[model samples]
Target: MFSWIKRGLLVSTALLSIGLVTTGTDYREVYAEEPLRLSKSVYEKPNIYKVDESEYALFHAVLPSSTDKYIHRDVSSAEVYTNYLLQFAYDMSMLKFGETISKQIEKPFQDEILPKLSEVVAETTNQLTENEWKQVKLSSKPTNGSGEKIFHLYNEESGEDIFRFHVRRDQPPKKGHWFNFHYHTFLDGHEGHHNLGDVYWGKNMPPKWMA
Candidate 1:
C-alpha cells in the first residue's frame, strides 16, 4: 500500500512539471508574437479617422514615403524645398488677413509672430515627406469677413490638414479690440491654441476680418 501511494505522488509531480512548461510557452508567445501582431496592425496603411467624415482632411498621413523613384513629381530638382514651403505657408497666412489688415500689422507680424511661427513649422518639416510635399496646399478663401479661421495647411492627396492658423478679435475690459493671432496643429489631437502674439486693432472692433 505505501509503495502504491509513493508511485501515485511521483506521477502527480511529473504532470505538474509538464503543465508548467506548457503554460510558460503560451505566455512567451503572448508576450512576443502578440505584440508583433498588434504593432503590425497599428502601422497598417490606409489609416482611417475615428471621427466624423468631415475630419478626414485632418489626419490622413498614415505613412508618407520619401523615396521618389516610386512616384513622379514636377519639382524633382527643387533644392530649397523646405524653405519654399515655409514661405508658401507664410504667404498664405498673410493673404487670409487681406490688404487692409495686413498693411497695419505687417512689421509686427513679421517681427513678433513670424519667428515663433517659423520655429513651429520647422519642427514638422522633417516629418513631412516628398509625397506629402507634392500634394500640400493652403486652404483658400479664409473666413473672408469677421470669422475665426485664417487658413490651414492641407494635403490634397492625403487629405490631411497639418496646421491651422487663426485670428480672433478680443475685447479685454477697457483694453480695446485686438487681433489675437494663433494656430492649431494635428499633433496633440489639435487641442488648445498656440498663440502667435497679438496686434492691436483699437476699440472699434476692426473692419470685418478681410473687409
Candidate 2:
C-alpha cells in the first residue's frame, strides 16, 4: 500500500510538470507566430497590400511604401503584427495618463513619474533603431478590387514581431496626420506606437507635445 501511494504521487507530479511546460510553450508560440524573419533575400521583393487605387493613394500619403501593389499573407503571423500595435498604443496611453494620475493621486511619486516615463520612451527608441525599421519597396500584386489595405511594421534583421497600421480610402484624416504607427513589447519590434492625435503637454519647460 505504501509503495502504491508513492507511485501515484510521483505520477501526478510528472503530469503536472508536463502540463506546465506545454502551457508555457503554447503562450510563447502565440507571440512568436510571425517572427520578423524574412526568408527571402533583401533584393527579393517583399509582399504588398491588396487595395484599390484610392486606398493605395491614401496609404502612400501616410506609409513609407505605396500600397498600390503589396502582398500580405493572412496567416497567424499577421495577427502577431496587429496585436503588437494594439498593445503598444494601450501602453503609451496608459503611461501618459499614469504619470498624470501619479502626480495628482500620490504627490510623492510626481518626481519619479516623469523620470520613469522618459526612461521608457528612450528604451522604446533604442529598440526601434536596433531593429532594421526602414522604408522598403513592396512586392507587386493584383488588388482584385479590394478597396482597403493593411500595413505592418516589421524588422527582418531584429527578428522581432511588431505592430500593424492600417490605411483606408474612406476614412477621414485625424489630427492632421494621414497614418498612425504603434508597437508592443518584445513581441513587437519597437517598444511603442506613434499617435497622430492632438496632445497637450501644457506650458511647462519642454511640453508634452514634444513627446
Candidate 3:
C-alpha cells in the first residue's frame, strides 16, 4: 500500500509539470500570432473633390489638341479630354498632399513643395505629350493668417492662371488643418474658367458648396 501511494504522488507531480509546460507554450503561441497595431499618423486617406464647372471654367475648357476642327466635331470626345486633364491635376495634387501629410512636418510647403511640384509637372507634361505650351509656372505668397501658405500655378507662356491651393489651420484648433484647392482653364487671353468648387483634404464629407 505504501509503495502504491508513493507511485501515485510521483505520477501526479509529473502530470502537473506537463500541464504547466503546455500552458506556457500556448501562451507564447498566442503572443506570436497577435497582429501589430498602427497609428492614424501612419496612414491617411486622400480626400479629393470633383471639379465643379459652375464655380470655375476649366472643367469645360478644351485641350489645344482637341481644338482642331476635325476633333472638335466630336463634342463628347472633347469633353472627355477636358475632364481627363482636370482629373490629372486633381490626382497629382492629392498625391503631393498625401506625401506632405505623411511626413507630419510643420512647414513642408516652404521647404520642398516647389521642387516636388516641378517634378510632378515635368513628368505629367511628358506623359501628356504636350509641348511647352502646357508648361506650368509656380508661385507662392504668405496669407494674412498665421501658419498659412497659398500657392498659384499658371501657364508658362500665356501667363494665365491654372490653379490656386491654400493650406491653412482649422479654426478653434481642435478641428485640425487641411488643403483647399481649385483649378482654372484659360478662355481667350487673360480670362479663364474657374472651378465652381474646390477640393479639400483630411475630410471625408463633401464641402458645403459641393453638398
Candidate 4:
C-alpha cells in the first residue's frame, strides 16, 4: 500500500507539469500580452531614404523638432527607447501617417493649385507689346492650409519655358507675397524640365522682392 501511494503521487506531479506546458501558462506570456513590441510601418518606396533603419531613425529624430512647439514638456530628459516602445509606437505612427498623406494625396495638388492662380508672362525684355500682352495673363489660386498659392507664368509667343512659383499665405506684412518654388519648362508634357523633389521643410525659395 505504501509503495502504491508514492507511485501515484509521482505520476500526478508529472501530469500537472505537462498540462501547464500545453496550456501556454508561462511568465513570459504575461509581458507579451501587454504591448511590449516595437513595430512600425516604414514607407520604403519612391526612395524616401537610403535604408529602412535610417528612415525610422530620421522620423524619430525630427519628431521632436516638428512636434516640440505643439507638445511642450518640463521633464528633465526623456529619451525614446525600447523600454518606452508602446508610447514611441503611438507617436511614430502619427508621423508616418502624415508622410503618407504628403506622398499620396497632398503632393499631386499642383493640378488643383496651378489652374486657379494668377499668371504673368512677359517677353524677353520683361515687357509685352499690346498684341503680345493679350497672349499673357496673370492669375492666383491658394489652398486652405498655410494659404499656399501657386503661380504659373506662361508666354503665348514661346508657349514654353513656363516658370512656376509657390507662395505661402503666412507672410507677415505682405498679404499676397509671391515666391519662386521651382523653374520647370516642360516640353509639351513629353519631358519634365525639373524633378521637383519632396518639399520636406517648405518652399526653399527667396521672396519676390528679395529675389
TM-score rank, highest first? 1, 3, 2, 4
Clashing pairs in 2: 47-71, 48-70, 48-71, 49-70, 85-163, 161-188, 182-193, 201-208
Q: What are the per-residue Cα lDDT tens digits for candidate 4 across 89-134?
A: 2232223224433343232333232222212111121333434433
In model 3, which runs have C-alpha deviations exceeding 4 angstroms?
Answer: 1-76, 100-156, 165-171, 182-211
RMSD of each: 23.9, 22.2, 26.6, 26.4
Tens digits of per-residue lDDT for model 1, 61-104: 22122211111223442323333333444465567677777777
State TM-scores per candidate. 0.56, 0.24, 0.27, 0.20
**Regions of candidate 4 where Cα sits further than 4 Å from its true position:** 1-131, 146-149, 155-161, 166-180, 186-211
TM-score of 1: 0.56
Pairs of colliding residues, candidate 1: none
How do the residues 1-211 of candidate 3 rate in per-residue lDDT, one tens digit apiece?
Answer: 0011111001112135334222221001000111111112311221112223344333223212122111111222332333333333333333444443433432333224432333333333333323433344444232332433344556555665644544433433445334433223333332533322222234332232111
If ranked by lDDT, best first, what sequence of candidates would result? 1, 3, 2, 4
Give me the runs in candidate 1 sitting further than 4 Å from their true place: 1-79
lDDT of model number 4: 0.27
TM-score of decoy 3: 0.27
| Higher-ranked by TM-score: 2 or 3 | 3
Please give the range of 10 consecutive residues that has the lowest summed lDDT in model 3. 1-10
